[model samples]
Target: MAALADAEHRLGRGLPDDLRQLLLECDGIIGHTAVDTVWSVEQIVAQNLLFRTDSSFAQLYMSFDALLFFGDNGGGDQFAFVQTPQRPDIFVWEHETDSRRWVAGDLRDYLGRSLAEGGDAWYQ
Candidate 1:
């Protein structure tokens, strides 16, 4: 749990006001979405988000890819993740104080960034 907290702290420092606002507005986002279930309020913290781990989104995109983080080094951190089709591998890009909220983007961003280095894919 300490590790999770530390990771979240690290990520928060890098997040931006926009993300914070987004979080506050939408209660955080997910990389891969699956299911019609509502998440517990406790599960939607600014740092952590809970979404379906394995779903159809993975199958629509090419095999798992990588991701890039756009969070800050300060107190506005965020995260991103790209999962493989077979879903064996996961590429993560994150910045936050709660490791639980380490994933903050969608599959498109994750896959695009995962192929690049340090958020370079965003340029593509």
Candidate 2:
């Protein structure tokens, strides 16, 4: 709980309830091919901060202000929760195309699919 509190403070926003509950159970989830399907609290804070503030990212991709990144695909793609409207749905941010698309209904559904028999790009 302390970690989550610190993360929320650093990000200046509350995390999704489902993600907070999951992190309380486990720091992170290692999914197919040993990927960090769900990132630890520290990583979540750091990554989101980077994506939101990095000047290089601003030039390279679309604004990340609406996305709270939580994990990666072991490649370049990343998974995140939409923050602008604050929804439970998970979306995949394709690094190459800079496209964001819906992948799961919630954290539980995301874990079920990402950890199942489908390598790192399970959502694709």
Best model number under TM-score: 2
Give the local distance difference test score of model 1. Answer: 0.32
Q: Rate the local accuracy (lDDT) of all candidates.
A: 0.32, 0.93
Measured on C-alpha atoms, candidate 2 has an lDDT of: 0.93
- lDDT tens digits by residue: candidate 1, 1-124: 3433443464333233333334445532332222111121233222232122335534443222233232222222333332222222223322222232232254344444533345422321
Model 1 TM-score is 0.22
Off by over 4 Å in 2: none
Q: Return the TM-score for each candidate structure.
A: 0.22, 0.97
Best by lDDT: 2
- Backbone clashes for every candidate come to 32, 0
The segments of candidate 1 whose C-alpha lies over 4 angstroms from its true place after superposition are: 1-14, 30-124
